[model samples]
Target: MIAQIGDRLVLEGTHLGDARRIGIVVAVAHADGTPPYEVRWLDTGRTSLIFPGAEARIENRHPDETSEPAR
Candidate 1:
């Protein structure tokens, strides 16, 4: 679930009309290094940043992942 430079962030697969998208974590923001990643979701050929917290998992990005709003 950890997001990395090649991990895929899948959102609402079946319930959301089977809508699926993929992207790479271009950047990560974390202080203590824990859950919640500032993911840059590549949706529908476009790029969108997100901080999917407890609602998400970490299986790719480094351990120093955070949810700080990108500036």
Candidate 2:
């Protein structure tokens, strides 16, 4: 998947009862916005370089005024 800095990377759990993990993309390895992103996780406050898996999805950044309402 393609992502930009500041976009949220959400990794859904593979098993039942596992919590979803969320992180912000701090750096992008490719100019075209491909994987190997440097992400800072919200839960652990740690950074990691990730080539995202099938369970991962991107949430693009948006202005406060233009953002959708929380579900």
Top candidate (TM-score): 2
Top of the candidates by lDDT: 2
Give candidate 2's TM-score: 0.86
Clashing pairs in 2: none
Off by over 4 Å in 2: 63-71
Summarize candidate 1's per-residue lDDT along 2-71 as a digit string, tens digits. Answer: 4455454555454546665445555555544333444456544546657664344444544565552232
Which ten residues in a row are the worst by lDDT in model 1?
30-39
For model 1, the superposed segments whose C-alpha errors exceed 4 Å read 14-16, 31-43, 53-71
**Worst 10 contiguous positions by lDDT, candidate 2:** 62-71
Q: Estimate each model's TM-score.
A: 0.43, 0.86
